[model samples]
Target: MEIVGSRRKNSSFSSADDAAVVSTIPLYRSAPELEVRLDDFELYAIHRLRVLKGISDGLSRGKKPNEMENLTKELWKVNMRNSEASEVANKDIISHYVLRLVYCREEELRKWFLSMETTLFRYRFQLETTDAQRALLKEFDLPYKAVSNAEYESVKEKLNQVVRSIGQPLSSADTIYYKVPFEQVPDLVATRRVFIFKGYAYVAMNQVVSLLMTQYRSHLSKALVLTNRKWTSMILEQEKDRLTPIVEALSTSYLGPDYSQPREYGEISLKDIDQVAKSSFPLCMRHLFEKLREDHHLKHGGRMQLGLFLKGVGLKLDDALAFWKAEFSRKVGAERFDKEYAYGIRHNYGKEGKRTDYTPYSCQKIISSTPGVGDHHGCPYRHFSEENLRAALDKMGVGNRAVQDVMDKVRNRHYQLACTLTFEAIHGASCDAGINHPNQYYNDSKNILESRVRATRMVDTLMYAEV
Candidate 1:
């Protein structure tokens, strides 16, 4: 991918014919016809193109009709011209540059940018042809090389053993091996996916994608940190304004895989909220709920966190308002509750103020946010001390073993992983999925329990049939 157009170039004033001319020049036209090789940074930038497109689409969601139409037109033009190698390359380069501007602003955003780009790289690499894969490897300048016939013969037995352990019957001769530093691919090492001899990991060619992605992520992460430090030191107002949409889009982006619509989870009435809070709420929300119940009040941050959660669980607007009013009225009186608190609830429901439909706080948002004194809005795994978190889990009836498991993850700053472990512990089932959002935790807990009931029923039916 090659960067096109000057920074000061005004696309806003470009006529339709001008766009046509711009789109005609292929970005990769300068490359040799039969083969293509991208520099390591260029490869990283190419992967970022897909991520930028996703961010742009997400950011455009709540725009005005005219703005949305223009965005749609731009997207259509990109799609129509994607068949041309130059247009694709130009689009990739431009999007990458835009995201660099957007992501350079904050550490969290930079990490998000790196993760997305790495995922894109993994996906694209998986889809590449063998020759293309070799080209990319050459560009990456990776230390791994194909095992020679003589080297394979020496390592044949051990390699076959590793392959058999993974439940595959691949022969040593048939398998292509790459000798890479074991430290470079810790995931493969931790998962026992590769055979290590001496200092190098004998990774099968098919499994190399994971190793490559890890390397890519590490390299890109460091690159981004350096880029952020350099870019954050400088202030360019016009460039900032130009990249504002990309930044805004990233903030609102729900990178989770499953965002189930409201109705699919079934209607959750205010009456059942207490029960749901006990059984379904994640530890963070559960903590907030308990605090609210005990005090009959919460700070603004806590209210926002719990309120949006209630909204997400399908509580009707009137029910949500009434629920808050009733709870707060216990200590503050009905008039005080109405006067002080009603508008904020209404605003969250999109019936007041900006009337924007607010989304519930995702795991990233909760984990990254800092709660001040008296606020209980942030993630417990992130914000809670080890002893306090352990005590809370003990009080909730989680066994010592499970509590220890969760604490181990928490200590590593894997807050979401800790949350997933908590879900598994409480449900008495392994949920082998990452917890990306609070709502996702709720939904997964519900699904796991429901699936257990289904499995039990199926077993009972089979037994009855045999009898």
Candidate 2:
């Protein structure tokens, strides 16, 4: 299927009124015609998705807002920046529109895209200078009542108290407080971060992003609903045949490295499997490993999940057969294992049936999988019960404070962030390389452990040489 915005011959490109330009606020109000190439359509959408995912990952890593700002700046520089200023601006605007089309299909997809886009806008808004922010408000026609000097002085003490309690130390003379209706800034009101006087919220200059964000979210949410309706009802039959599949697939696309290639790392021995799992595996794989060991058999889903991950981590097919045979032999003898279970293991290695070499599941795939009773597959952060997840964290020796933080991420449905938190708690260091795929986590953890070992060996060699 062709992309949505491909230009036809003799058609006007972008109008002067709809020129591609990046502004302080990227409120995409109008759809502009573009001369986008077929290849550029998927490329632009992937790049923008990475930026949005970077924001989600930053928050998942427990980064403060200032830290998240730095993270996104670097991501933009790497992913969205172009040599020309206008080109960069075009990418930003065009990519945003492309993703809107991709994500406007379902309610869940729309909600996720809306939340990430709003957070992105809020981060950019927070970085603008005060004058720039005011200009943006004026440009967007967001009217706010600036408190008079006399009215500000009347409530100066109360404003100071509220702002101070919220850790914003702005003196009365220095700050420009806006008197927005309490309803407009309900988040601040509910959190008791702003001083309320008569039906108005006294929001400090730095806090105006909250009001703007609320408005932006409301507008974008309604726009997505309308877009979905139009997408289904108004598109021409020819356009639907060309555009539907490409747009739908963009939402669940995985842009990470391929895991189906031949193993570059050396083969892992069956004897070392337990040690390797403990040291390098993500919690999902580790949990599955333990279950397989305990029960001496795993259901089909668990076998596929853990089995593919093992293959990705350099477990050769021979060792894999031995490993599964040993476990299955405990319950149903080696004969039964070879008769019933051995074919599936060989199939995963591309030696039987259709012989299709399947890639390991990414975090998105695992998170979306629905595991029924007796299944040990899927992301533990997303699938495990809270009590079970907390116990798992405790077993891994994650301290109480970090456990609470992980739990908070889980409660907010930030499953990947919870996994990142658990990684930090165990390693006692930040997971600088965010976890997007199960094999990525495994590779990262193994590299870290290997580095520590090499460092320790170097220190030992120096001490022995001196002796």
Scored by TM-score, the top model is 2
List the candidate 1 regions with Cα displacement exceeding 4 Å.
1-105, 143-154, 169-176, 234-236, 239-242, 255-276, 279-283, 295-300, 312-355, 367-375, 379-467
Tell me the lDDT of model 1 at 228. Answer: 64
Candidate 2 C-alpha lDDT tens digits along 1-467: 00011122211212344343334666787776788876677788889999887787677666887899888778877998877878877788888888888889777678779988998888787777655676555445655433345666677788879877878765644456667778888778888998887888877667778888888889889888888888788752446666676786687666778786534456778878889888778889999999999999999999999998898888889888999998999999999999999999999989999897867887866876778998999899989999999998898778999999999989978788888878878886787767888888877777777889999999999999999
Per-residue alpha-carbon lDDT of model 1 for 241-289, expressed as tens digits?
A: 5444445555555555433235457668877788888888998999999
Q: Which lDDT values do the candidates have, in the order given?
A: 0.67, 0.79
Q: Which residue pairs come into collision in candidate 2?
A: none
**How displaced is residue 19 in candidate 2, in Å?**
19
The runs of at least 3 residues in candidate 2 whose Cα sits more than 4 Å from the true structure, single-residue gaps closed, are 1-22, 106-108, 129-131, 139-153, 167-175, 228-249, 255-257, 262-264, 269-275, 291-307, 316-359, 364-376, 397-421, 424-436, 448-467
User: What is the overall TM-score of model 2 with all chains considered together?
Assistant: 0.74
For each candidate in turn, the TM-score is 0.57, 0.74
